[model samples]
Target: MKLVKHWIEKIFATITEGIVGALDVFFSSLQKWFGVGSMPYIFVLPNLLIFGVFILFPMLLNFVYAFTGGTDFFPNRRPWVGTANFTRLFECQNFLVPNSCSEDLFWRAVFNTAGYVVAQVTVMVAMSLITALILNRSIKGQAFFRSVFFYPVMLSPIVVALIWKWILQENGLLNAIILSLGFDKMPFLVDANWARFWVVIISVWALMGFYTLILLAGLQSIPADLYEAAKIDGANAWQSFSKITLPLLMPTMLVVLVLSLIRAVQVFDIVFAFTGGGPGTATLYMVQYIYNNGFASPTKQYGLSASSSLVMAGALIVLTMIQLYVRREDV
Candidate 1:
């Protein structure tokens, strides 16, 4: 024990010395070139440059493109149209009634996305919470079950979608079973409502494990003594869960909710692979519409696509802001 402690101490001391030497050399060079007061800015300059290059520059270009009409990819060739794209997008007799808009498909995408997020997030969070609670209990094959649930999380989204697509196709395994039961083959992806339903279900199934793992982490962190004390006071499972679990789990729940909503809003690959935004655009979510407009459209309305992207970006910003507020409040 004494030898192990001595080795650990020596290791930490060496690390500390190395950090101190590096910092000293760095500051000396900075002081020689500039001054101590400029150290903070100098240190942040590289990160700022990287951020500007990778994030800020792309965002600025997207924003600029939103104001320019274009079939051409080059900004130099794209004609400046000011806010004409926005004006066209917003030209509606009534904002609430999406059909009144010039870009009715865009508005339909927005509405579909909103509904999808609400339903998907609600089911996803609830199922994850339930799964986490069940998993938190002592059980045989617990680790095995956890691995099984989380296996889907490791698979690529497209792969998952394709696998599900095969199962849900007209002449797939599911229909094979249905036929064996003397029932008709179902058009799971061909029908609009069915496509939307399957999209949400598949999304939840693919993602449940990730959120379950998160909730499980939160569940495990709660001191066992709290549950013990509650038990001594004759608290039943419902009482214990509602009072102890929910309250303590609130922060994690909020995080899961926000993340689920963001992911739900941004859902694309699965819907694309599984349904292809078909059955008369019933399952067309905003991101899919953005892709269709930005790339697949006959004219390829880049400005309109950029404008749609900005709307999605705005939703993302609001979600991020909400997350920040919730975390701060929790703190």
Candidate 2:
């Protein structure tokens, strides 16, 4: 076994050395051909090309399409209608409400999305951080518990949604359990408020483990010596955590926050599968609305869908920028 291990190490080392030597020679040649400054561009060109083709092109097309009444493909004869899509979207009202003046469905979707983002992100990040902190400490069977907590994260979102759907259904496990306890069978996914509640709850449950793993990685990256120094200075657990752990963990926390915020704002699969936009559009998130407008509905409002997507993307960008700015000031 030792001999096999030694040979394996040698083979891997040789292969790595060969690759490194090849890369060195290739770069040297490239520098000679394109000059030293241009060599960086050569190295970056592949990724730049891919990003331009996949991300930039699609975004540019969407922006253009938002201004035109186009279907799946761009209309050849349609004239440019400046801001009409945006205007129509703003003026649109909920289908169920005939005379309600203030409750525009688009605005409702935006508000609901904002609320969902705030609630779920807060709960997910805080719970994940606490879980990470606990798991980072010395504990028995830490690996097992970590895996158990993170198992939900490994499952597909569709699978998670399906399982939760069944669990939260009227006659599902939850109601069965509640009935057993002599309590009324609650409508977890039927009532508007209750449906939204379960959506957020299930989202948190499905995502907390993933965020916990990320925070745990960050926690482990924190040097033990810092904790030791805090201990020597007579810092209690809470004091040390507040003064040292949190400050050090801020960068990772910021990353988790941004990611969670993005996911929350763009949430679709669970919302689609669980509520299908709802007990009367109560849980209709922005992405789901976009999906409904672009594809699911009989009257395909492509322009409106594109406009909504652009709006959602812009909102996310602004929020992310604000978060980054805050993080920078903290640093």
The digit string of per-residue lDDT tens for model 2 on 146-204 reads 99888988878789889998888888999999999999999888799888888888889
Which ranges in model 2 have alpha carbons more than 4 Å from their true place? 1-53, 70-73, 92-103, 322-331
lDDT over C-alpha atoms for residue 313 of model 1 = 96
lDDT of each: 0.91, 0.85
Q: Could you tell me the TM-score of candidate 2?
A: 0.80
Alpha-carbon TM-score of each model against the true structure: 0.84, 0.80
User: How accurate locally is residue 293 in candidate 2, as Cα lDDT from 0 to 100?
Assistant: 82
| Candidate with maximal lDDT | 1
What's the lDDT for residue 104 in model 2? 66
